[model samples]
Each structure stands twice: as structure tokens, then as C-alpha cells.
Target: MHQNTRQRLINNFPRSSAQHLPNTSNANGSSNLRRVGYIEYDMSRMLGESVKTFVYVGYVVEKSLESIVDKKKVAVKKIVCGSAEDCQKNLQEVKILLNCDEHENIVKYYKTETDQDFNVYIAMELCLGTLQQWMEGNIPTIQPENVNPVQLLKQTTKGVAYLHGKRDAIIHRDLKPDNILLKLVGGKVCVKIADFGISRVLPHERTSLTIKTYSGTRGWKSPEILNAHSSPPGNLRAHPRMTRATDIFSLGCVFYYVLSGGRHPFDQNGNSPNPELRDPNILRDRKNTKIEHFSPRIGGYIRLLEQMIDKAPQQRPSAAEILSSPLFWGHDKELNFLVHISNLMQENKSPVIQWCKNQIEEDHSNNEDEFLPGLELNNVGWMNRTCEALDFYFMYESPRTYDEFLTKDLIRAIRNMGTHYETLSPSVKASVGSLPGKFMAFWNNRFPFLVQTVWNVCKVLITDPDFDSVLMFYQTG
Candidate 1:
């Protein structure tokens, strides 16, 4: 491990009973350490054998009691690296996950952990199950009355939002009946986003994050992605970079499938021109792919596809903007739930605020275990420098002044949260409630005077007159 990353792990390691405690201390005073092990194991661990250990739910990985006993509930993604591209894919995924973490309908990304070749994992929330299972088996069959247009709109938005990339082909390659999943907590349903390996980031402007080849299943490819018409002159080989429109095309297919009761929209009825529906380049046959055309009454549900499946990448609305569309107002159940949770968080101070005040006031000088994730999580120089301006205010100015700054920031966060909540719909809002307390605590202690500064930074970045698109996170389908 690099010295900087090792220290980051030590500083951010949580104090919880769920993690196993081992006798791992060394003579040196380092709070934590990573050892190089040479164990005698059979050839099975070499081939990346799939052994199903009872770990976090909705996960495809192995786990041991010692490592995960404490963080018992986190959903981790474990990928067995078998090729150079696989390793590079994991690294690129880690880079993107770390830098960009925004959006309401998208899954909350935590940290990516690398455990040599023996193991690799991406820990996130554990949701109920996939959408394919829900649509083909239970929900559509038993609860037809509960088919929610708004919730479907919002949930799919979240799926495409995560799949939103700097490059267009960075879409959900495996977008199908079975890939979508749902989990309910606190009496509200939330969309769970997953499957990173098959997915890649799409580039926005002409840049390096562009697609290298046409990957993913054949069924999900867009018209342009499926054909070689975009090939540059004098070159027989096409430019393989997938565009933003790739996902919108797949999204059109997914919605058509759901509306058709698991029927393929492209299936032929004797007179079909392209009976296979394998080539996405020809979409004229799709008018017959839908199971039943959306009526003016229900037509609204599928009508939005006119723009989403446009042949051009520039025509599709971004994931964040789509979440705010009027088409989602009445159909989705998840959107309604997010709206409620966001409103709840907007009132007064959040629970995390009280937790931080209690911790800072009571533990100011008290003795505690060395494993606490406070103090050096970020360098004191950097962490303190965030408040360099506030330092003068706190030392020379009154506490009342700092309190006012805090209140203003909290209010701003609440208002922003409201817009985000409305975009995400309620299902997403409910899921995010898990972290507000932690975020609030961190905001008050870490930033000290957040309301006054974060917006100042946001204004210069997000809304500046000279601003253009080079996103830390891309939220479009």
C-alpha cells in the first residue's frame, strides 16, 4: 500500500462492533498496517473460483467473518481480475466512483477496496432484487393495480443516471429485464444500482474517457452503436467509442419490453423486414415491438421516448434534468417517496448535527480508542485550511457569528436537497436518509462554516458564465 492511501484507510476506518477484532498490533505505533502474506493454499483460489460465502445480500462476492463481521450490512461487489483489461476496468471504476458522487435517482457509492488478486470489492447498499425478476414474476402478475408510471419513470431515470457517462456508450450494457433491482427500507422503496464491470463511463466532450470498442450484449446496442455507418472515411474499421445516445436507445428497448409484458418488441409477425432485431441501426420496426401502443390516457407513459431514442446523442435530456420532467409527476412511486424524505430532512437541523455537537463538546479532551475516524481523516493542514477564514472569525469573532454561518449553510443544503429530492422522486429520497446524519455531522465539524463557502465555490463552478461541460459526474441517459 502507498503511504498516503494506507493513512487514509487508518484515518477513515469506522469504530463499530460489526467488524471483527484480531490481535494485529505491531511493535511500531502505527494504528493500522497491511501485511504481505505468503500462504500455502490449493490451486482453487488461483482460478478465482466462485465460493458463495454468506456475506452481504444482493452481492456476488466472498467474505470472511474477521473482515466483515462489523460492517455486516454493506453490499459489496467482488470481481475476480483475470485479464489486463479487467484490472484497468477496476481501476477506472475506482477513479470515477471516487471523483463523482451526485444525483438523486442514482445509487450512493461509498468506497472501492482492492484486496490483491485473492479478492476485490466495491461496497454499497444492499437492495431487494433485480427488475427483470420483479416484472416477469411477481409485481406485474400479482399487483397489476399497483403498476406505477411515475415510479417506473423515476427508477429507470436512476438506473440511466448511474449509467450516464462522459462517453455515450458508457451506458448499462446489460440493461434488460433482470438487471433492475428494488429494496424497501423504512416503509419506502428505493432503486438499487449495480453491475459496474459490464458498464463503462461515456465521455461528454471529446476526451480520453471515450469508448475503445463495442462491448455489452447485442440486444442492448443503439442504432448507431449496432451499425458501422459512423466509420471515418478511408477506414473499414468503425470508431468504437459508444455515444450518449447508446443508452437512450437501450432505455427505449427496456421500456418497450416492460410495456409488452416481457415480449420482445422486435419479434416478427410473418411480414417483418428484419426478423432478428439484432441490428440496432434499423429502428423503424420498433413501432411494432411494443406490446400495446400507449393510449392518449396511458400513451403519456411511453410517449417521452420520442426524444430519448433520438438517433442523435445531443437530443437526449440528461439524467438530472429528466428526473425533473413533468412526465414523472404522477407515474412513479419512488419519486413520491424521495419527495417526502427530502422534505423531512429539510425541517430544522438534521440528527447528525446534534450528534456532532455532542461528540465535539464531550470528547474535546477525553481519552478514546486510537481507531476513531476523526482527527487525521484529512490532513490537519488541509482540513484546518478549509476553515482558515473561519479560524479568524472563531478566535477573534463571537460564537454567535459562527452559529449564523452554520444556520445559513444548513438552510442552503436543505433547499438544494429539496431540488435534488424532487428530481430523484421519493424512492431515492428515502434511501439517502441513511447518510444525512453523517453528512451533517461532518459538515459542521469538518467545514465549520459550510453555508458561506460551499455555495461560493458552487457558484464559481456550476453557474459561472464561462462554464462548459467537463463533469465530475455525468447524469444523463
Candidate 2:
């Protein structure tokens, strides 16, 4: 909203803009998202310890129609890359983030730009330090050499909820303490979720792949995900199907570290009281014992965490289910207290959202679909066509037709999805419910052509978009 930021949005918009695509609409066609002017705020600042040309980024400033760098005032994401794959991966992550939009707690993206030398830069809010730093500090010193397990689980729940209910169910594949940034904003703890570049979308097909290389730190991979068959590990394995449960495993590792005062579950040098990690399955057998004996604040939460990091892909919890779990109930009062304070502050500031405030009087007079509540043509037909680059990703290879857009890779994704859905625990299946209605609908409709060779496709479901509801009031007038 600053002056320079305003100017940036105007200057940065792609020239000779294409016709705006229509979004899903109910009666009056109001669900469509309009392009807006915005500024790209300065999200870069030199880090004191980092030497990899890494800059602490600030959020993008999308005010009206521009991209401008802001002064080093607000927190942002740190942008770094080592290759072309990293560059492509960065943009892919951005596209996913754009679809996700904003949540009160999720880190924000104001503007993105490419450098003079062709390197891409993502500008966004930066956090002060990771949770690992804090745990290694006074919190560990004050206690009787023990950590507050309850507080740890509560914070994790708070963050996971923001990703789940708050921001369209994003799965943070690597949930270790080092990635959890703990900051002091206005004297209150403002936990900002970071490192989405390595973060894979579990149910959503995000994260581009080139080589079947191992990603994420060694200690964090799930048993199934860890390419351990070869010496030095991960040398000769077929690329594994990424599932929603992969993140659950990573979260378990995170929970283990947080509850145990920054000590890694897979300790290498054997410097702590804990036993050494021989294999990834150590988490599976030791989950209940460790939670019962070690943690104070997060004592009971570990059982819930075990459900997430299950050794089997089918055993883990989806991000959505984790939020609704009884284990996170203690976190409820804290979240509500904060939401109440937020509501009171907002009540003092403004009114409820009126997205179609500019609705025309005459436009309300013309709508044949007013009789139908949730039915409407999804002008967002481009969901499939627009993302043809990921054609095989939706229903990738196998018995599928070689000619169709949704290739073998995508068909595999669809297959993995059905397999995961059917095999998941009841709680997790309930959690995976109705997340990708439009995309699935688009994929399912394409099957006779796209997946003709493939048989036994999963059942499809698509929900009425909220955008359609907005159009109703205006079109029915």
C-alpha cells in the first residue's frame, strides 16, 4: 500500500494481457477472480550468518497494479537457488501459492520477479529464527532438562491448522524445527510457516520433478520414502509415489524433536540419552513410549503424531484430519481466544465482506439459472487445459492412451490417489474428503479419452463453488 509499491504493480503486469478466463459462477457469474493491481515489495535483506547470497525476503506488495520493493520492515521468505530445476520449481511453488491465496497466519507473497541475469527471485515475509534456535536457547535452560510437550504440540497444531483449515490443506513435508520460524511480532508469538519450495502438495499435484533424486534432509524421510536399498542410499529406486501420508511421517519427526528439547530422533554421534536410529522404523515402535515417558507439554499429542507418521502410506492422517483430532482439543481454547481478539479488533475496524458491492441493478434482472442453487458452468474450464504441461501428472502412464493430454504420470497420480483414499484409516479418509472437486471432475470427464486403456478409475466428486453463491444474489435480483 506504500507509494513505491503502488507504482511497481502498474509497471510489472504482463503486457498485452490475454482475455480474462471466467471462473465458476452460479447464476450471475460472480465467482470469477478479477486481476488486481499490486506492488512487489522489497523482500530481500542480507542475512548475518548465511553466505550463499541468500537474502531475507519481504512480502509482495499487490496494492493496485504494480511490483515495487519495500524497505526492510515486514517479514518475508528467503529466496535461494542452485539450478534451473530450482528456478522451475520456484515458479511451480508460486503457482500453487497463488491458488492458495492468503490466510491470517500463512506467510504472504506480495510480488515475484526475475533478476537481471535471468535468476528468479520471490519476495515475501521473513522470520527471525527457526524453532530449533529457541529450543536450543533459554527454554531448555530454565526447565529441569526437560521440554514442555503440551506447548510444543499446541504450537504444531496451531501451525498445521493454518495450513489445513486456514490455507486449503497444504501439507508441509518437512516439518522439522529448523524450518519452523518463531518470531516476536508485537510481543506475541507469530509462528510463520516457511520452506514451501521443498514442501510437496500431498493431495494436490504440485512440486515438479526432473530426476528421481532424493529431496529433503536425510533424517526426515519416511521409511517408504527413504531410498535405503543402496549403499549411501537412494541410488537405484523407482521414483516413489508421493502421498498425503509422507508429510505425516515428517511431522512425527518434528514432534519427536520438539518434545525432546531439540534432540533429533535419528541422532548420529550418540551424544544424547536416546538410543541411536538404526532405521526409519524407530519412529514407529518408539512413538508411544517416548511420548509417555519424555514430554510434559506434548505428552498426549505424540499418539496423534504416530497416526501421521505411520510407516505405511495408508496409515497416516491427512492434514485436515489432524486438525479435527481430539488430541488437538487443548489447542482449541487458545485458537478461539486469538480468533475472538481478532474479531473484536476487526469489529472496531469494518464490516462483513461484500464481494459484489459493484453489482449492477439491471444485471440482477437477467438470470435463468436462479432456480438452481449450486449448479453452474465452471468457466474455469482451463483447470485441465491450462495445466496441460502437467497432463500426464494427473493420470500419468500405464494402460492409459498415449495420445491424451493427461499422460502416464498424471494417471499414476490419479491411481495413487484412489489407492491412498481406499487404504487410509477412516479418520484420514474423512479428512481427504472433497478437497479437489473441480480438478477431479475435470480429470474424470477426460477418462474415456485420456484414460481409455486404464481401467478401474476412482470415483469422482465435485462440489458447488462458493463463487456461484455470490452470483446468485446479483442474478436473481
The global C-alpha lDDT for each of the candidates, from Candidate 1 onward, is: 0.43, 0.43
Each prediction's TM-score versus the true structure: 0.48, 0.48
Q: Estimate, for each residue in 105-140, the C-alpha lDDT of model 2 and write its tens digit.
A: 455555555432334445555656666676767333
Question: For candidate 1, lDDT tens digit of each residue in 234-337?
Answer: 55444544554566666766666565455444545313435366454344434443313432222323334545655566776566666544444321322232
Error of 2 at 128 (Å): 2.6
lDDT of 2 at 20: 27
Least accurate 10 contiguous residues by lDDT in model 2: 453-462
Worst 10 residues of 1 by lDDT: 35-44
Candidate 2 structure, TM-score to reference: 0.48
Off by over 4 Å in 2: 1-53, 57-72, 75-86, 138-152, 158-169, 202-212, 228-239, 268-302, 330-477
